[model samples]
Target: MSSRGTDVEDAVDSEVAAPARGTGTRRRVGYVAGLFGLLLLLLLGAVVVLVAQGSIAIPIGEVLRVLTGQDAQSQLSRTIVLDARLPKVVAGLLAGAALAVGGAQMQTLFRNPLADPFVLGVSSGAILGASIVILGTSGVGWLSGLGLVSQLGVTGAAVAGAAGVLLIALGIARRVGDPVVVLVVGVMLGYLAGAVVDMLVYYTDPDRLQALATFTRGSVRNVTWNELQVIAVSCAVVLVLSVFLAQPLNALLLGDRYAGSLGVNVRRVHFLSLASVAVLSGITTAYCGAIAFVGLAAPHLARGLLRTADHRVVLPASALIGAVIVLVAEYVAGGNGLTKTSLPLNSVTAFVGAPVILWVLLSGRARRQAG
Candidate 1:
């Protein structure tokens, strides 16, 4: 009788363990699925808000109608919705996602919480590249007439500039044990790029200066449908590449040695990551100007909210959050109802980003040296 009772208890224990494990697995799966759903909903909401609350306030119903297979409100509304507002929203969505993804990868690459896409001088390089094109072009009077070659050339130069900075920063980071030192090195690289941009601007024609100023401050209002085509194609290519890199990036978060043990080629991952980030940052800066903070803040916010340092989640999550932040900023600054003039994208973003950056610094997260 004692032996039989023991056997029955053993069977119960086994049954309980199986369900326990199963329940845990289901919970985790549900949590991740829920987060993904929330992100999708947020992005959808951002699109709705951006379209509905523009300079000419289109009704939510109208926005929904146009989004569906419905007819045009007017030729003007149709053009505005399809041509102007939609492209701007799309550009914001893409640009935000690109910057945030790049920035999130950068944080993981550096193994530091505060690392952002612009920290490694990508934005400055892009600005320098775009400035050169603007100063040299004849067809675009003061940044007015950039054709495809010039745009591609600018994006290429920006990518080159970004790659150059990444190589240098990576070298410095590898040699330096302290995260603070690495961040300082990044800052210096940015300053150097900014100095170069300044020198180019100084020698540039006064007529060209206006365009340079606009690009540096950042704005999505000026992007036409044709220019957006370039952005869409390039961003789509880079984004797909990002999805493929996500798993490898996860291995990396466990440390280079561990990743190597797990059969990940760290060097190849680094090279590909640098290229991907360069393309993402460069193309966005070329089209929309150097919009700051989204790259810097989006990843940080996503990680904080998700409570995981894992890049696999951080990367896509950052993209979705970035789209939300940028579109909201656009609505605020798009000169819809409050005023006739729009606010600079940089200005609105910095207002939020600067404080978060300061918080990081004050909390010693940015200042901490990796031991």
Candidate 2:
């Protein structure tokens, strides 16, 4: 009742509330860290299992030995683990991470939950670029057979194609100033690119078409160490750059005007993000073929699990989730050695992605109705 007594009581309550808030913050951080650790373990497990369980069935011990620089029991085991399965597994990791990060960036940049490289024509652009090179070149065999110079040329073409589509889409998006319109434009661009690729395939030699066919049906098996070098360097660089862009991306989520008010160079952020996505999507498509859905699904899954759209968390979480999805899909597709014929990576990814797409649509609809 007295002023002094009341003041003392208020100070005591403030101290108690501060400690409670700190504890809650610590608990949340721990929960997130635990989830990340579990994801990492799953990734490591998937890698080992995939590398070990191919047609030859290398033992897990030998797989670890080869991975850890120890000698395998047999030279054949070493070759199978290293020269065969390891590349594919590594490619899966890199491609998944790249696509997922690209997808997360696309979703933020466009402010559309469904935006992704595959959906938005970036992957198709890369495919068209590579198809032109593959269809135009004389006596070209499979991608792996191409010399390093030729391979680089094709990869370069893919990057250019991705960039071309991205620039066009961004320009149209700027002019229209509508996310829905941008989405439609992107889909149309994808269709146009696909039509051109189809025409090229129709006119090309049947034998040459085999190389192009692999581009549509995603598979990492063909990625050689040589090709891996390109995928590794480009994806690594772009992925690292994405880390730096996370804050700017989060700012963009609040809207360009607000982001600009906050001193974010909206145009520069857009350029860098678009460029990074182009590079990531293009390089992954070049090596692994037009893998689908990992990008689209991974970001959604990451956000759902992490329960946050903060790019700092979503970006890395999406990478790990995407890698795990690819590895699991690869195993199911034929890496398990259960079937003589392997399913396309896209086929497997569809099983995972389709449900997520539906869930997103339904959840969004529910939110709108409730609002």
Candidate 3:
């Protein structure tokens, strides 16, 4: 064929290929979007059920009435639904979403599907950080009595602690380049942080120990509206910030070298991602205690359900899935009056998280070095 005719044929082929590529991309996006819609519905249903079926067992109709500012059957039902169940539900929602998003980011940043804030001891660091302030200030009667100030102080401390551990883990991963080694280092750091917390607890008075005990076990039931305000505000800020991280993180998924070639600052992306993980994990730990496995399992579940590692889809989907998991866990752990004695959140999350960890190990993902 003449050179001009060959060029014309190539142009036609290129035009045809473009539409097929666009169609495939649109199909994937649609699938993920549909999954997200379903997840949102599940989360909504879980919230309604939690609010209506808690210890007092308010009817769904009554709960809806109180929520919409309409009158319930009785003043007592209104008080129970509005005052008590609402805050716990809000806390669970925010905390779950925060952890899941953080996990998605961490998994991407570390390039390990198994990496999660809680699994790597980031939560332990937060607990230790909050313990210092809670223990140190307990002796000062006036300081301990300063409610909001004291709460913020502890929250701030927890954030700092989580950041410290995350930085250390990232540093080690940078040096070692081995995901397994870095994972071990994170566990050691967590144990070290926990050891320090134990020392502080030993010196703390009996009165203080009771509070620490409750905080360590992880429960959303005790979260008051004031505390929920702090968790909700902080989580909302970090979650929004995470939206910006999503594109960079998806770039990093290819490998630091490829991401850098694509104009991504690998170091800067790593820093910001780990920082977000720290904030999400720290604040949740400070308020809800070190609820486990939500961080470790939710991202994996997001990926599995959506069948893609695209952070744009995975991040939000993970958040909704995490919220559902935590709310359901709370309900099963006696929030719904299934049992008189409440169980810790970790107890429930472990069932989901442990198997995921095992799958990662067995699947050879953990054998690869960090990217």
Give TM-scores for every candidate, taking all chains together and pairing residue i with residue i: 0.91, 0.97, 0.90
**In terms of TM-score, how similar is model 3 to the real structure?**
0.90
Each prediction's RMSD over C-alphas, in Å, is 2.9, 1.3, 3.4
Instruction: Please give the lDDT score for candidate 1.
Output: 0.81
Question: Candidate 2 has which clashing residue pairs, if any?
Answer: none
Candidate number achieving the greatest TM-score relative to the actual structure? 2
Poorest 10 consecutive residues of model 1 by lDDT? 138-147
Task: Please report the candidate that would top lDDT against the real structure.
Answer: 2
What lDDT tens digits, residue by residue, belong to model 2 across residues 1-371? 69999999999999999999999999989999999999999999999999999778888988899999997799999998889888999999999999999999999888888889988899999999988988777645558567778788888899999999988888887798887788899999999999999888888888788888877899998788888998999999999999999999999999999999999999999989999999998899888999998999999999999989999999999999999999999999999997899999999999999999899999999999999
Could you give candidate 1's per-residue lDDT for residues 143-167 as a string of tens digits?
Answer: 4576677778877877777777877
Full-model lDDT for every candidate: 0.81, 0.91, 0.85
Candidate 2: Cα lDDT at 44: 100
Which parts of model 2 are misplaced by more than 4 Å? 1-6
Error of 3 at 219 (Å): 0.7
User: How much is 330 displaced in model 2, in angstroms?
Assistant: 0.8
